[model samples]
Target: MDKTFTYQELQKYNGKDGNPAYVSYKGTVYDVTESDLWKNGRHQNLHDAGDDMSLLIDQAPHGVEVFERELVKEVGKLV
Candidate 1:
């Protein structure tokens, strides 16, 4: 079963100070720490980790398929 994480709980994995970076999109949390783009918990200096990117993603030049294409690991779901 997938684990559930509240927004508050998710913040702890912000990929800062050796923490793992996690981001949410459409209620699903993805582990983006391994992606060089997400280094230090920031993406292209435009987005931050520990955030629900559902809205921001819509404005992105790419679609949600980037997640699948990149093979980003799904860590859990947002509550």
Candidate 2:
């Protein structure tokens, strides 16, 4: 079954030790905890997990291509 998480619920998985870092982009939640770039739940030390990053994408040096290239997998949907 597909999982659906609220903003508050998603915040709990903030990439901390033993926590599953999850970030939302375009309404989709992705498990970024496994990526080295997201080690400790931080992406480039600029952004963290547990929040929607749709607007932030524009500020990124790269674009949506990072998602495909980094091999991040969607884990759920933000509700």
Candidate 3:
């Protein structure tokens, strides 16, 4: 399934904070808050949890708002 997300939507999460955005291939929940790359709107580094973020939403330029609006769907808050 295709999915996407925005920086704002990404912020409302915490790493492995006893919640998960997506069920991993290994049957694990990736805590968004655990990823350091998501800090301060800058993804300077790659982390394992990033893959989970992809399952929840696909990131695109702001102009792609039309597409991004439905990325998360029922997961987390509705876009």
Candidate 4:
């Protein structure tokens, strides 16, 4: 079964200090820790992990293709 996370629980993986990085999109959480672009939990120095990025995608230079391209794996769901 898929794991579930509360907003506060999901906020723990912000990628700082070499911690695992995670981000939520459309209520699904993805493990972005292994991604080079997400070093230190920051994506392109603009976006950070541990939060919902669904609304931020439109502002990104690219589209949903970024997820497929990165092959980011879903880890859980936001409660």
Instruction: Identify the candidate with maximal lDDT.
Output: 1
Error of 2 at 67 (Å): 2.0
- List pairs with backbone clashes in candidate 4: none
The alpha-carbon deviation from the true structure for residue 65 of candidate 2, after best TM-score superposition, in angstroms, is: 1.8
Q: Please report, as a residue range, the 10-residue window in candidate 2 with the lowest summed lDDT.
A: 64-73
Please give, for residues 1-79, the per-residue lDDT of candidate 3 as tens digits.
Answer: 2243444444434334543333122222233333333453233443333243444334433332322333322333223
TM agreement with the true structure for every prediction: 0.92, 0.90, 0.22, 0.88
Look at candidate 1 and give me any clashing residue pairs: none
Residues 46-65 of candidate 2 have per-residue lDDT tens digits of 99888789999999999877
| Span of ten consecutive residues with least summed lDDT in model 3 | 22-31
Global Cα RMSD, each model: 1.2, 1.4, 11.5, 1.4
- Local distance difference test, candidate 4: 0.86
lDDT preference between candidates 1 and 4, better one = 1
Q: What is the lDDT of residue 13 in candidate 2?
A: 86
In order of listing, the candidates' clash counts read 0, 0, 8, 0
Global Cα lDDT for candidate 3: 0.34
